[model samples]
Target: MTEANGTTELPKTCKAGVVVNEGPDFTVAVEDVPVPTPGPNDLLIKLNATGICYSDIHYMLNDLPMGSMSSYGVRSPGHEGAGVVVALGSNVTTWKVGDRAGIKPVYDCCFACELCWSGRESYCDAAPQIGLNFPGSYQQYVLSPARYTQRIPDGVDDFVAGPIMCSGSTIYCSLKEAGLRAGSWAVFPGAGGGVGHMGVQIAKAMGMRVVGIDGGEEKRELCMKLGCEAFVDFTKVEDVAAEVVRICDGKGAHGVFVTASSAPAYASAPGMLRISGKIMCIGIPPIGTAFAGADPLLLIGKNLTFSGTKVGSLLDTARALEFAARGQLKPIYEVFPVAKLPEAVAKLRSGKVAGRLVVDFNA
Candidate 1:
């Protein structure tokens, strides 16, 4: 179904991993869904791969205080997507058919907002999230605004580019905002997970020494291979913070990036930092389940600061992709076919995935 204009004919319906039940006991089942038409300013994307993130689990479980996906009638939950533009909206002149594009967490934001103008568009309250409010990447064919869609560079593959859309870019922005100088010790609390592993590589690529904290031998090996100077297994250690402090020249880490959503990880973060060191919060625990803070006396005594960041802006995502293109940031991931998407989601929910898990839509 090829046309003279090089546009491939789109199918009337396509496969999708729809959420069976929108609750804590939910399951994702593959189903046939109708392909949506692009708006005047949108591009119809045919996704090739999408990465499974823990945030997807949170959306399905409906644990976060944020509204549930079902409220907005969004059944599929995913954000990291890489694909080709199969059809272009009549008003879209910047992109053409067959161009490579990527979809991130923030689907669209109000360009008139102050946050959007200040390079923090991800925080714009008026913006709609991909998996939360809109149909997400789990669907085979998705519509993306031509202005916000990311252009995939020549050297980076779709598999690596997929996770970079969210996990990689998010951590890169966190490390950048921490403002730690090169050679400074940067510690990642969940160094073996999808976001933590990317932080390790990005931190190393920026010339910072990375010390990873996680459990199990598989994660240790993975972290070490990905450029972690030291891997601390929390399961075997009596005091995880003490080990991190001891590794950083007996002082403490310059910056501690909390990537694990567990409450204990946030509780022990301050104990792993030196005087004037900072804690950059990236993982979001369920509301009222955990809090990250230190005593006012300890904060004043040590001159410590705490900060947090969400997904990166368009500029940050571009810089992260540049790092990948230059062979600096390499994403460690396992690929699964579309039929095994449910299994992949279950594995991610269990918290045993050493690296990212990607689902290939065309496989």
Candidate 2:
């Protein structure tokens, strides 16, 4: 019950997020919209903070699959969010007013699907993605299925917890896919960005040595500070693969998480893995893009495996938040007011952001 600017009104007809039309020219802008109501088994949340994810940019750029907007009648594009539940429907008993909740990537899934039944709901063929398919958390208030939302513990702040809903969980799930045990070496290509930074900490927490590869001296320093054993400035390194091998004692990393969607990262991965090393792809490459420079023969020769992971399931997201509450995971973020989202998105597009950019709705 933190007061917003010391006000109690809570602004019923408050400002909300809207993406005006879709396509390559889609634009996200704020508009005065009605506050939502909770439906059966749903909860209405007053968002305190939400992170600007790469997929938000990708969706805005027409680089991902956005569900039919004609059915929903609005363009609300956000998922990585942390807020307080304000209202709940009749069937929702596990949560109540003022409970902390996270609206993540996997908004809902058909429980009848085989993948959902097996606890791998993240891969459910009929999964519904918030921001892509349904209304999401960029607005002042959002309605989320109570069962799909993860609880945020008391001590974790909303601004820091928001990004975990998507970027943090995605990287955590990708690292899980790598199947590296303690003492293994894991490389993160975009080690200073939102997901990559989280990957660095998650790997380190699991007792793995991490080599962070990214651009700029500051990013290198940042990665090293975030528990990466070594930092390579890919922008300055002449041979990225050679540097990775050099850092791994002339063999190669045991696992590499490609958190950067750039072509070169994927192109250099096969050469950066040790024999039988796994490569986990977490980035959303541009639409219609393929894994460049990766050959089937090379995979067969080295006994290498490649896996692409999306964001995690509701259960996985809950585990991720629990890890954060226990101090095993953290998200580096730059907070801004909701009015400044366009500027934040602009900085994100220009690669000026040092970490995850979060919007503070209460600011």
Candidate 3:
């Protein structure tokens, strides 16, 4: 129960989607877990929605060479979480109970690190990941460090804000690193998936012309609706690279943003770019199974640049939220009840999801 003054009657136990097995063959089960208390500099947040990301699948499969979530004794796997703060830590005076908050991929990083000071805190070695090294938002009641929490604006819905915490901000960071200005040609491979769709919107909002590459009519419609100037259906096109080059005025895209983990996406990216074009790598393919590179001659001749980025810093997330609040970025997502989290995870694993899939705890 919540009082008018924002005081909450804390619950002893809350519903959570706990991982049944922590390996390749794993499942999510709904269970009652003990509610976590806020630390001296933390806040107790009651999550309304959490977006499912492919990174969660990697953590559960124990792949990616990043170690297993079990190493940290974490069961629930989720990072994009939007909710309301129900309690504040004793030492936290910046946030109040009932304030809207969201948790990002990086739970906390050492503030004194060089990377943290240089606007690259997401790569800080001392950072603990939200779902990997800490109990994540799959638990209804979770604790968040007040310093790293994102303040959700009043107009943005939870479903839209949740995915922005990760997918939206991640692609936004990659786009910023690409350094493409307005009217530049931005190509998005796998442009209809969770992260890719958000990239389409953000790039379009930034005044860049977007070309989306994916298979099927559904994704084509989505990309077109989201402001893609051109779309290539790989399933129907005999040569995806040729199609992308043709669409980009016969020169090729200014930047290729690879948001799909498929190896083919990486292999075909360089060919779809013009001279001096850049490749912004966002998706993680299976460890050691894939790589993105071009021959020395091609790299030197074309002067192409390859850059990779992890999640975004707090500033990047704030800017992403501003886009959402200003009606420029709207994330497309499907909602699932907490009990059907397993079904949602399976759908995402199938690689057919058009946009993001979010699980609602209060549903």
Candidate 4:
């Protein structure tokens, strides 16, 4: 295949990080697996790096109540992928064999759906997640739909390209949904987390005065280094909500971006909203739970808007990549070998990781 393609030879078996004893006892182990063949309109990507997201932990542990990876016949879990295309299907034309591409949260959507037509394909009801519904980027080789796979720009390296596949781009969409103008105070509840940190940088880039909410000195330093105008350490504050209210001229901030999954973060979010302010819900709670700011009366009284957004569309992802290429949005991640995926996932599950964790398939 290398002689035919003038590049990497196709290997019958490739190394992959496979999940074992999924659900609370989940573990990832590197093993040799059969390389997949690309279907029509698909591209076989030899992934150089993949980003580890907390959602991968939920899928591995069955933390979300709805569905399990086993139920979908999925063993490897990952969505953030950055690599080069080694093979293409018969019908592919838009991409070359060696083009750089990245995987995203949503793998493919039904193009015929109303949501897909309306430019909201991320929320398409029939959308299949890359890692959850299919074999994801945990392996050295993975397949992505040719049209859906994002093209990585020339200037962005794999380390930065991988996280933008999901976190950076998703938060970019959320900051746009926030609709806050320049100089408005916008607070990120989990500013030290991957998505929250992305929000902080993009929000600041958008000319908004940013405040970051997190737990300790490490996170505070990280937030401050990311250009957050103010940092609120929730552990030391008597009342984080009151502190935010105090910081924003006693009327609360103009916007609050909730990127933490903690119940307390959701509970105290409304208290940080000013009159007519917005709270962009970017986190997911455990199954069967509701956000604490779901009170109709509070929204009515404050005339506030509460909205939820999922990941970004393909166009949004491309634009977000431009942001990274231009150095406007930067990613902070700790890279590890694919063999250390279980450890990375454990660290992320422990909630102690300050930023994103990425795995190099060849490291």
What overall lDDT goes with each candidate model? 0.92, 0.82, 0.91, 0.88
User: Candidate 3: what lDDT?
Assistant: 0.91
Estimate, for each residue in 262-339, the C-alpha lDDT of model 4 and write its tens digit.
888988999898999998888777765656565789889999888888889998888889988999888899999877
Q: Relative to the unseen true structure, what is the C-alpha lDDT of residue 288 in candidate 3, on a scale of 0 to 100?
A: 77
Q: Model 2 lDDT vs. the true structure?
A: 0.82
- Clash pairs, candidate 2, are none
Ranking by TM-score: 1, 3, 4, 2
Structural similarity to truth (TM-score) of each candidate = 0.98, 0.93, 0.97, 0.96
lDDT of 1: 0.92
Best candidate, lDDT-wise?
1
The list of candidate 4 runs beyond 4 A from truth reads: 1-8
Taking the candidates one at a time, how many backbone clashes does each contain? Answer: 0, 0, 0, 0
In model 3, the number of clashes is 0
Tens-place lDDT per residue, model 2, 25-137, is 76778887887667888888888999998787776676655554435665767888898987778788888787888889888778997898877898887777787777777
Between which residue pairs do clashes occur in model 4? Answer: none
2 or 4, greater by lDDT: 4
lDDT tens string, model 1, 1-363?
A: 121156546689998999988887899999899998998899989999999899999899999888999999999989999999888887888998889999999999889989999999999988789988989999989989998999999999899999999999999999989999999999999999999999999999999999999999999999999999999999999999999999999999999999999999999999999999999999978778878999999899999999999999998998989999999888889998998899999999899899899999989
Model 4 lDDT at residue 87: 90
- The alpha-carbon deviation from the true structure for residue 63 of candidate 1, after best TM-score superposition, in angstroms, is 1.0
